[model samples]
Target: MATSISFVGLSCFLLSLCLVCSLKEGYAFEELIESYAESYLTHTFEVSSLFASSICNHSTKANERESTFRVVDKYGPCFQPSLHRSVVPPSLTDIIRSDRARIYSIQARLSKNSGRRDLIVEPNSLGIPIIDGSAFDTLSYLVKVGLGTPKKDLSLILDTGSRLTWTQCEPCRSCYKQSEPLYDRDDSNSYVTIPRNDPVCEYVRRPVDPPRPINLCSYEISYGDGSVSVGFFSKETLTMSAAEKINSFLFGCGTDNKGPFNLVAGILGLNQEDASIVFQTAQKYNKIFSYCLPSSTSSTGHLTFGSQTPAPAGIKYTKLVAEKSPFYGLDLIGIGLGGTKLNIPESIFTTPGTIIDSGAVFSYLPPVAYMTFRDKFRVAMSAYPLIPGPTAAIETCYDFSKSTSVTVPEISFFFKDGTIVGIPGKYSFIEYNTTLTCLGFQDGGDKHSIIGNKVQRTMEVVYDVPGQRVGFAPNGCS
Candidate 1:
């Protein structure tokens, strides 16, 4: 059996040896060291600290509606009740493939000639823990919520850009394997299928679709990466926590679901759509929500609904471009490296606009903007030797095995109205191995850019729909 090595507690010599055994099997240690020295020098401290606190244990205790629950990385050491008892942890290839698929889906979805629409709703509050799914083969966040009358726990991907909330349901024609059991409408007294004629079904209705049975409200959502979820558009009681529940919550019970969901039950859409949980209970929560994404996969963060949990003090506000409906849009103007602004033109960002998304793992910039940022970053890292990236999407990689100390330039984002959000070294670069670290930003093509969750880690992100503004606060998650 091949032994897995974690750099956190291992000695440097052991780590160097393990690199050859684990990452480059059959390679001699001396040969590996010679090749490494000729190309790069890396260290273990920063990389080790990244995984230092990632262990998670499941708790049977019920949490208060207003209180937060534990969050874990789906592929980290802490994710409990492994998806498959004997399945080995996903390899790097799997993670890169899944992440690329997700990125393609997002870019393809946004490239379509889609219009933006807004809905009005009221507000209230509730709290739930959010899991980071960046480790292994997934690059999204997960949330644990209850579905139906008796409430069966389901882990769903939390996506701010998605409009419809959904989960795999019973009688699956085609469904991916999930840790939680498929939701059974027969078992839930609160399950209520919406009528085809009901106005609610019109939101997702296709223009070329023929008429269907009045009682059958069907819905289908497809992604660019060929993932699709099709099933009934229904309503049910959504249990937010032990103390809070939302009645007549609109959601999709996916009967034919297939995709790279990473074994999670379904997706919890948090966009501004009428069918979204944000709007469904808008009156109760006031359309205000906030979340703090933990910096490391081993750490925990939260997703809070309403004003019950106050926004962190000294929070900075930025305008949410109202035109970019269904997405929390922001006017990203510039980028700074080592406290020095890049020479890229501001129009490079303003032309296509940008949206902050929780589902995307890495931030993406326009080609010109990304090139400028990458070039500046490379210059700053000139002391370190460049190496091939672990994935196609990530082009800038460094080998740092020889250095005892490293100095990473601070990267910051400049938004409209001069809101400068600093990106911590950990959030800006992902340590793929003790020998390799890559910048987190990617090339988003010429279309609209995206600010993924990696850069948002450890910061409190407040989405105030009614207020038409987004806020950021640093160190909100400890």
Candidate 2:
């Protein structure tokens, strides 16, 4: 059995590492951190405390700054900013630039080190035309916004650039038909638009390049990623369900120079802590929204507008760590695998970072941790030495079939509040091969490593942006 260790704490989180662990009470520590989840819309709090109170309070609850954000009580809580703050590292400007050069160098190495997997690979997403720098499905399933009576059932991207939520007018835009069309505001009969240039608009606005010279109450936005989104500011009704709905949102409808995105029309921002269509609507009717992501590489995912996506009943849920920013992250003080805090050796803990990012497809375990875990895992699995590997299951492949469920180790996360969330079961095995005989999987990368989505899917990631915290457990969120 493994016990918890302490690290650092919040506010004073700038010390190389951002957190520490400190257990409270003498309550048997719950044997394991109890898994649970709670979601409240911004209206749940006051708008005046968007980044301050709502976000701060949430951060205080979960104890990290990775997931909370403040939204004006006057508007709503939609984006978590803590995840998008001023933590500069050699400048992303530089990292983005160096990617192309680095890719050419790592291609051969990556190909030569492939492995095996137990999961099935998706096929529909293969060979899709992606803009440079677009990794994975970053460019998939675009959704366009619209106000009034517009289009319906169209595929669109939920962009962070534009503020308006308008789709193509009747008869559609002369450009290309988006992969998905805009929702007809009039048809659902629940759409409502906010005023032009409201406080919410100012916060969500992403300025566009080659600014369009026009206005019927509008704005423009450009992205650091080189893409652009533009539209007139206005309120729109959202007919989520027969009983749930909201009539307020910022959106645009006009000529976008960023010529039709193939299979994409606009962007549906599922962002909002208290306000956005989903949260606001949820607040008004006491409901929750859910989206589903398919693990298949060949099929498409579904991002539904209303109702919580049905989840496996036994999968435990965890409350997300809220923070004061525009992004979401894990609420982790630290992670100790196999109940061993010092298993990784001081050399790795002192290193810069080991983060959990949903945007990133894999988990990055340090070499020290990987090796330590790999060896112990092997010893535990001494029963099945020549077992089959789960090709895409782990960043590193392994097949020692010691009954994945049987050899489940006590993997734990150190939280700022002295609480540890111990994850049960080895989400995957550690393998040592790159041959086809190894299995159907991705080859591990050189710099440290990534655990990827496969493992991430096993944990319920509570990304409370305004609070700057990330809560992790053995299940995914609703």
Best by TM-score: 1
Q: For residue 129, what is the lDDT in candidate 1? A: 14
lDDT, residue 341, candidate 1: 71
lDDT of 1 by residue, 196-247 (tens): 7889987664323322443678887765444667788999988876777888
TM accuracy, model 1: 0.79
Candidate 1 off by > 4 Å: 1-45, 52-54, 57-71, 83-112, 116-137, 206-214, 401-405
CA error at residue 205 for candidate 1, angstroms: 3.2
* Candidate 2 residue-wise lDDT at 437: 15
Clashes of 2: 132
Model 2: per-residue Cα lDDT over 226-291, one tens digit each: 344455445665433333334555455434424323334454544433334434445442323332
lDDT of 2 at 455: 46
